[model samples]
Target chain A: MTESGHSSGGGMTARLVAAPRVRRGARQKVGDIVLSVVLIVLSLFMIVPLVWLITTSVTTRAEAFQLPPRWIPTPPTLANYAEINSLIPIGRMALNSLIVSVLATAGALLTSTLAAYAFSRIRFRGGNTLFSVLLAALMVPVQLTVIPLFILMRTLGLVDNLAAVWLPATVNVFGIFFLRQYFASIPRDLDEAARIDGAGHLRILFQIMLPLAMPALSALTIFLFEATWNNYFWPSIFLQSNEQMTLPVGLVQLQGAVGGGPAVVVFAAITAVVLPVLILFLIFQRSFVESIASTGLKA
Target chain B: MSSAPVAVSTVRRRGIEGRSNLAGWFFVSPAVLLFIVFIAGPFVAAMGLSLFSWDLLTPARFVGMENFTRLFGDATVWLSLRNTFVFAFASVVTHIVIGLALAVAVNRPLHKVVQYVTRSAIFFPFLISWAAVSLLWKYVLDPDFGIASYYLGRIGITPPNWLIDPQWALPALIGIDWWHTIGYTFVILLAGLQTVPGIYHEAAKIDGANAWQRFWHVTLPIMAPTLVFAMIITFIGAFQIFEPMRIITDGGPSDSTRSIVLYLYQQAFESFQVGYASTIALVVFAIVMIVTLLQLRLSRRWMGHD
Candidate 1:
């Protein structure tokens, strides 16, 4: 639990904490092979649902529901893709998701980065107490807040509007906590050196701290974006109509429709919702994994 | 020290402090504003609302403790609580068990590319939204025309109506949850496993300790903190289970799958009892806070003994 092996926000931390691999005996090699076989098969269990989703989305109805489901459609069609929007107006829902995720992530990052700087670098009265208050806010489940938040949203006339989804998201308590940890880990001399050169706190945070804190910042961005994109409950509650819903909410509505609104089309809708995240995962795989792995250190 | 210089330095320090005090509040004001408006305000509202009888359509009427008194006797509340506990217990046990196994299995002298591929494949499912995952599972568990059914049938075991049957619904949700979230726990455990110094295992091996003994003695102790952390997080997340129940079963098959949060939502939105729902929400906060505090205390005790 000590912060000796790896601190919070450094590029080389992962390398430093990684234990060197020891040479294995002949018996262990055989065990490794067996473990590999078992894990790869298990990994297939993890992936097959997604693969089936894409395959089902691309297939015709006949190919989709046939006994012993087809891995690939005989003539994979773009036909279901066309029908998804018509059936559920999923394209509009996706736009709503995109707007909410982007706005919220950007707002969270900006505000949290600023607050984190103040917390880590500046001396102020009641700073520790305020930090504790935010930490307390972090633990109360979002469900607990919804009863009142629903009222607030209604009072603001933001129900059925994307603004409601993204507004409260603008201030992420976890993001502040995370960025503060990362900011605190950096050596004070680096920012002090900037201060000696006549730079203010803003300049120091942007020029020195932020660039160095990119490792944690990007990780936080990925998570904030993912959380915003994937959220189902509040959006489902606040959003009244289909057009205002996020993609996940829309997908549920689609499923609840007649006969689950054609299996092929629903899968197509699901795929569209998952596509952005899947692409982000592929692109930022290392940072994403490292960020998640580093979360253990919080223990 | 000279008194003049000491006084000068004190003045300088006070000046700097004055400036930083302003700057600090300035930087953090946005966050403070948002927190008060969104989180703190809502929490206070929740407390006040819990004491009143209000539906969204009507002005709140003072009815202190009525909702709370009713909470103790509601059959659905107790049923959902039981189901949630069972689900959380199962989730925590399974996640830690499988997560540790997977991490230990992969902490080996595998090729770099092989390691990356294996890790990515297992972890990929964690990235997909729960909503998408829930919908995709319906297809996978479809009785007549699903791959699971097709495969299980071939093996001479019938796959039950997963999301429908009351007996199978909760278990099926647990299975799907494991598939979706175990990767996160696996990654945490994996990181913990990798941080264990190679020298300890080598020393254990030199003492003629077998793999199990080395793991049970050395690795398990080293990874205990990560295990505890993952267990608490997984349990908390599982306890708040909503998406799958809302989308998949709608808390059906005799209300067997209705989670506490889902039930709260039903009361608040469907039944339009905001006061009762706020009380339920308080119950959730209390339970989570109590459990988290209990976990921290127990972990402290256990770690102290260790």
Candidate 2:
């Protein structure tokens, strides 16, 4: 973009252009190469541990324990992966994680979009105050609220239930704030035309607004799903029983019990936990980066 | 009488204005209800609970100012608070410096493939949960037959028991935390960097300014707010550090790595001290707000100078 921009500004005097262009060539070429090298080095630093993780996961337990640690498992086996089931209810836990993530993400999408639409478009009694309160809640860290939530769950006889996990996840104050901003940026004229055609708020949101905000909404969905799936703190603290525990919590237990001795099992558990999100990120790499980038630009 | 009833019904229904107001309420009610039930109501209840002593099994009995007074004298509280500050401080510094460096390096007009690989590599660790990354490092840093020991031994340096030794444990956690989260800060700054107009650098160049001068005078000023935003979020996240200590260290080796949040959890769950935990919760809340406000004030001066 920068280079193209420079070329398009060709209207500048030849001397001005030529001087910098020459300097840019010599200086920038050297600088960029330096930075490129730096980038690769940093990239390698980030990737090596992940490589070690995958390699270690595939190795046999005996090979894993061996000194001058085998980078390549001499006859890589899935025995550890098979043993993971007897070790813990790994499959069931994955299903629990999946179910909770889906439910929470869906609920968040529905509730936040509705609230965002109302906040952005409609002027109602107490609306501003309500929105302000929601924003104010952002200052209160989620960790602080857990004690109260635990009590609340206990009071409601939901001490060990998944409800305690998913209910709070479904409504994020930040999500409402973000989608409101995104929805507001959209030209009101687009929705105004729909209103003129006798369309209702629901129709306007679903048909006109949501389609336009799909990129942002999907980005939000990706974030919420990953967070809920990867969440360990709340689930670990609240859900005591194994059946209700999500993958993150379950994987930790698998380590505590059977993963104590076999390094391979531990690595395999971590890999299994990380793999789904890694694959999703690869598939949606462009938009995920864009959404994150765009978020930063907002502040 | 029939006409009167009809007229009253029409006025009550009141066409677009009334109906639209109802619609607005309907739209926002779910979120509002969630706020009231989960956040607002629980917060108030917890505040009340702080003024009383109660185990989970027993009925509440009021004991005013006891938990509050107990909080200041608690030695573990101070230790945990100090550890939290240290962790948060180290995390913020490392993340901002390294993340910005990575972003600036990537932002230069690199090849498309180079850009993609750098981004994916940086973000990959961040995608994994804290539990996994913490455990992964715990294994990697295992003193016996672990890679850290193996490699460092070759250089004739004995690696300390990374998780067991008090001195090395916190630093080890700090390094792992940096590895896990630097990507988030990088993406944020990269986004901010792109928002910097190319023309500013060009104008600076035309004035015979060097690269450093351009970055300092032009780019830094433009990027200050975004950098502050990144720092604030990173600090908040760091301050709430729990998973790593809970999983790997278990707040061990003379209580070196016990953060405020982890301490609060143990106080509540392990000891069943709900009232005291609520008091600790308030402290956490107060500290976060005060520090965040302080950051905002400092950022004002920071941006003003730039």
Candidate 3:
């Protein structure tokens, strides 16, 4: 009887695990199929407009206006792309955007990393209070500061220059916060060992800490680059001259110049302006999603 | 000899501490300087500028409390504030509900390729700049020769002139904003959902809890903090909505869709009422701070984090 009971107990344990699997399999199959269908519909909602934009870019002015709008361009052509360049130096504006965004990203990464290292590793007087004040700065809207900043830029003769668009943005609170958290996570013994080897604070930060924090730095770089690249409001306000205008501000002028003309040309201009950043995003999609997700969770 | 060595070590320690302190200051100086010059200085200047009237062309004159009083009486300010609140509220609600639903759907047991493709498709629009999004929608929503109109007509419904019709303009902008931004919220919620341990669901299932009960009891509580974070950020962003209105409608056929930021821009640039615009900016700042603080306080009660 004892042997039979032991055999029954073993069977009970096996059934406990396997029973749920069999039940869940039947239920989850239906759920998964329904969920997949819903997700496909939602994905289409997101993708169709972009596909439409691309199709519209290649369509002729007359075909663009046809009812039951064409899903695919009929005899797709590159004429609209050519027309955009002639109307407003689209290539020059894209280059301007690239230069400003790259410089701003570099400057921000430098300043934020240095400051984050100091804040995370060094125990100076009032450091916590100072860091709190920096955090508070995040809550202040850019709108409140724009008027005075614009005036200050004008006084410094930086208006209508790319400096005006990027200077104020070079010091970012979010970047500092993100990197500081990363620095704090690093083990203290590493810094202690470096100190014993007679490494200076700058040496330690540059050589030891930075290499270990490359993941965080790359994520921050992508975030800052995307933000600076897509920046519109600040560039619009700071840049007045057509020659100094970035892609976003230039696109607005192109829109005004087109004046309800061929939809295809405007579509072409939009596509050209957005394609570089879109490509960058696709390449670094993991970094983009990870950084944003972590920021949200940590905040 | 022992005393001598101890004293030498003491002096060396002091020297190292002092040198490191100096280095700390040096490292942080650039960020501190930029912050003071750009952020802190402008904030104070905005406060001062609101008390004096000056067009960039002329000498400033002090007019204490006049801008504030003028803001109080300005009907356009009231109108813009009301519209902003409506847009912001609708944005927060729709984004949370739809984003959570999307996250739940994607979090289910589905094929790996479908999961990745769905996520990429949903998030693609978010990477594009607001300027491009605003323009793209303008073409799609055009009353004549627009695809939206064409499709709606095919389904036997007349599409209103979206950007022109006062009643539909704000709703149209809201819809465009959802298309532009819901991906961000989805990704955030998806991350949150992934963090909820599967053991809790298994236990709940053993207790014979149904799917809805498990979600309501186990999933919601575990995801509370993330939901709160997403909600607050979404509210903050929605309140600052400017690009769509400025680009598509230009504050509309009847001033129905003018956001507070657009109003401030018009006052400062078009009318040259720099002082009054600063006052408006201050009001916007105060409202955002108070609402954020209030949300934090309220979340504690429901978030179950003592």
> Local distance difference test, per candidate?
0.86, 0.84, 0.86
lDDT of model 1 at residue B209? 87
The alpha-carbon RMSD values of the candidates against the true structure, listed in the order shown, are 7.3, 4.4, 3.7
Candidate 2 lDDT over residue span A158-244, tens digit each: 877888889888888878988999999999999999999999999999999999999789878877787898899999988887788
Model 2's CAPRI class? Answer: medium
For residues A1-299, could you state the per-residue lDDT of candidate 3 as single tens digits?
22443455668776666666666767778888888888888798788778788888889877775667788777898888989877778888888898999889998899999999999999776677889899877888998999999888989999999999888889998899999999999999999999999988889999999999998888788778888988888998899987898988888876674346756788899988777666867897888898777766655
Deviation from native of the Cα of residue A161 in model 1, angstroms = 0.9
Candidate 1 i-RMS: 1.3
Error of 2 at A178 (Å): 0.8
Summarize candidate 1's per-residue lDDT along A199-255 as a digit string, tens digits. 999999999999999988888888888789889888989998988989878888777
> Model 3 off-target regions past 4 Å?
A1-24, A257-259, B1-14, B295-306
Local error of candidate 1 at residue A275 (angstroms): 3.2
Candidate 1 docks at the CAPRI level of medium
Error (Å) of candidate 2 at residue B198 is: 0.5
Return whichever of 1 and 2 wins on DockQ.
Answer: 2
Candidate order, TM-score descending? 3, 1, 2
The model with the greater TM-score, 1 or 3, is 3
Q: Which ten residues in a row have the lowest lDDT in candidate 2 chain A?
A: A1-10
Clashing pairs in 2: none
